[model samples]
Target: MDKANQSQQVTELTLAGLTDDPRLKGPLFVLFLLVYFITLAGNLGMVALIRSSSQLQSPMYFFLGNLSLLDACYASVVAPRTLMNLLMEKKTISLVGCAAQLFFFIGFGSTECFLLAAMAYDRYVAICNPLLYQSIMSHRVCVLLVAGSYVLGLLHSLVHTEFAFSLPFCPPAEIDDFYCEIMPVLAVSCSNTQVNRHLILGLGGLVEMVTILAVLVSYSFILSAVSKISSFKGRHKAFSTCTSHLTGVTIFHGSILALNFRPRPTDTLSTDKTFAVFYSLVVPMLNPLIYSFRNREVKSALREFVVWK
Candidate 1:
């Protein structure tokens, strides 16, 4: 049979979920269900708080609000499907469903990376050129940055998704991940995927390098500006303001690094699952706490909003 026919024949795929033990299904489902709720509530609430609070109308919060939105979306792309599959005996997903999941999962994740870099740039401007912060990060500029991030994300995801699904999947149709990740799907293809893997590494690495370089450069400038501040308290305060963004970036990029740089994440299924859970579930729920809840302004805003309500 021709390759197109072989590809067409793959109508659905089975997921080898988090565990095979039937006894553990109930516990796992409950655990992930609770996590999903917290992720949605935390991230969505952050967006609402940022939008409603007059105090949070700064460029920093503008970037943060979008980050919250992206985290919620990124988690949703994996969490709900994971929860559903946990309940089902077969854990089967349609080809289209798998494709959609992978597309959005990669898209949102890539967007978040760019968004974090944008946030770092915002911090740089605020620290390095305080007087020009407002003018430089004008509303128009912020919107354009966000739009560009999404465009880049979509392009990256589209290329990888199309390439992954284009190859004919050899049957059993079982993916080793709970969600349809690109690499796992590619691993199952009948076609020789060495070139595709290399291309993926090249493009993914390029994106990673660009974003990380932006973050590093921005922070280096910020540190330089902070060092010039003579007062100990003043310098401390400046860095304190950035602590949240730094924390969020560290956690997010740390997970990405572990997955990519450790001899490929898929080589060790247990390690892959650990980072997968970290990316798909833990990060979203933690982002609000890391970025906003711990901030003085957001706390005050929340208190005021509560009192008013």
Candidate 2:
């Protein structure tokens, strides 16, 4: 069909759950509910803990609080919808709602990728360039980095959403996997999705690759610097600071790579669902725990607060 005709063809779509088996519904609901609750509590708790603790007033903690907030936001976009689908019979979303989900999912997710890179740089400065750490990461500089990450995220999401919805959808919008994903959305489109698919592959796929590259490059330098530390105790402390950042990076980028760049879509969806669980649910829960609970300062603050309470 021509562009004009395709434009006028259709706009709405029907979505399908990954599995229609009635037997799986109850188990999935219970499992996802538990995951969602832990993710919410872990991320929200980290934000609150950071804010209340005076010792965590540095740029590191500031970035951490933002990271936790993004995790909560990202998980909220996907997890709750997934949970609702399991419980509800209809499992339908409007075109606008789907678009909104796509926008925020990409937005927060892109932001988290950049934020992870920024945090890696922060650790690099603190560990590798200790003398310039404070001077380089001043409050104003920190704010600018965080703002830039969000702006980049917004732009990326806009590009993906615009191209995604431009295609025509005759019917059958049933998105498997409990949320509105781009692949499922494109699958039911009446018009040929070659251009839309290429756009997603070029824009969204390339950006994710770039983000992963940036993260890997930052950590490479971090690892080299950590290895050079003379004292065993000093090296241990340095590596500990990076442990949480590394954990978060591994989960987020690893899942994206698996789901987006896989060899076959049909073969990957089941595995993709598992990757999605890691990215959207498990990672959020683990990020705060890895960072907050492992840090001496946060643990100390928690203890002091407990004693005083």
Candidate 3:
């Protein structure tokens, strides 16, 4: 077949969404709708709270606010489409639409990885070098870090999306996952995808490893500092400050590693989907709850804002 004919043949792809069980659609839709609602409310509420409250003007909350915004964005990219697909008997997505989803999904995800690493570094400075925290983590520095995260994310997504979409895809172009994820979409290509597979492994692995290493190193220093504190109350206080962030790191990295890093049989479609749900849906909702409930200052600011309103 000529290039034009092949392109015409695969102009649109179908999404084999989460499940095909007719009995489960209603319950799953209701459940996913509730989750998406909470994700929006929690993430938007966090961002609004951070922006409105003078008490949250620090670098830590600034990063947290950006993280919240990203959660909302990436969730929106996938959740609405997933919800719509649930209601339709024939779940179809245009080729262009799939590419768009892949781009934004990866862009936001990679940005979040770097942003989380930046947050870890922020915690390290605040805990390990309290005296120098203000000077080192200035407003200008925070802005640059956040900007760099988004920039790197865009570039990373561009490279992967371009390369992935360049491969010729023949018929039976149905993606097994709910969304246009890298691996699942690549699985549909007719051309030789060994290079693309290796790239996914190499590039994706490098990004995750570097960001995770940064978080680990930062926490190592933080733990060392906490251990040296003379008073029991001081140690407890230090640990409390880090607990929420540590929890966030664990959940985010753990889910991604399980999905991407682990060796998988080709038949583990259901398992991959489960991991995707946790990181994409569950973690975003959990992040705001963790930060807001754990931090006294955020609670106080929320209370103050409520009363003022």
Each candidate's lDDT (Cα)? 0.88, 0.81, 0.90
Instruction: Compose the digit string of candidate 2's lDDT tens values, residues 133-217.
Output: 9999999999998999999998998988888887666534456666777777777666688987898889877778777787778
Which one wins on lDDT? 3
On residues 1-309, what C-alpha lDDT tens digit does candidate 3 reach at each position?
A: 564366558988889999999898899899989999999999999999999999999999999999999999989999999999999988889888999999998899899999999999999999998899999999999999999999998889998999999888877688998989988899888778899889888888888999999999999999899999999999999888889988888888888888788877663778889898887777778899999899999999999999999
Provide the TM-score for each candidate, comma-separated: 0.96, 0.91, 0.96
CA displacement after TM-score superposition, residue 305 of candidate 3 (Å): 1.7
> What order do you get sorting by lDDT, best first?
3, 1, 2
Tens digits of per-residue lDDT for model 1, 158-260: 9999888878885777999999988888877888898778878898888888999999999999999899999999999898889999899899888887776
Task: Name the lDDT of candidate 3.
Answer: 0.90
Clashing pairs in 2: 13-173, 14-172, 14-173, 14-174, 15-173, 15-174, 15-175, 16-174, 16-175
Give the winner by TM-score: 1 or 2.
1
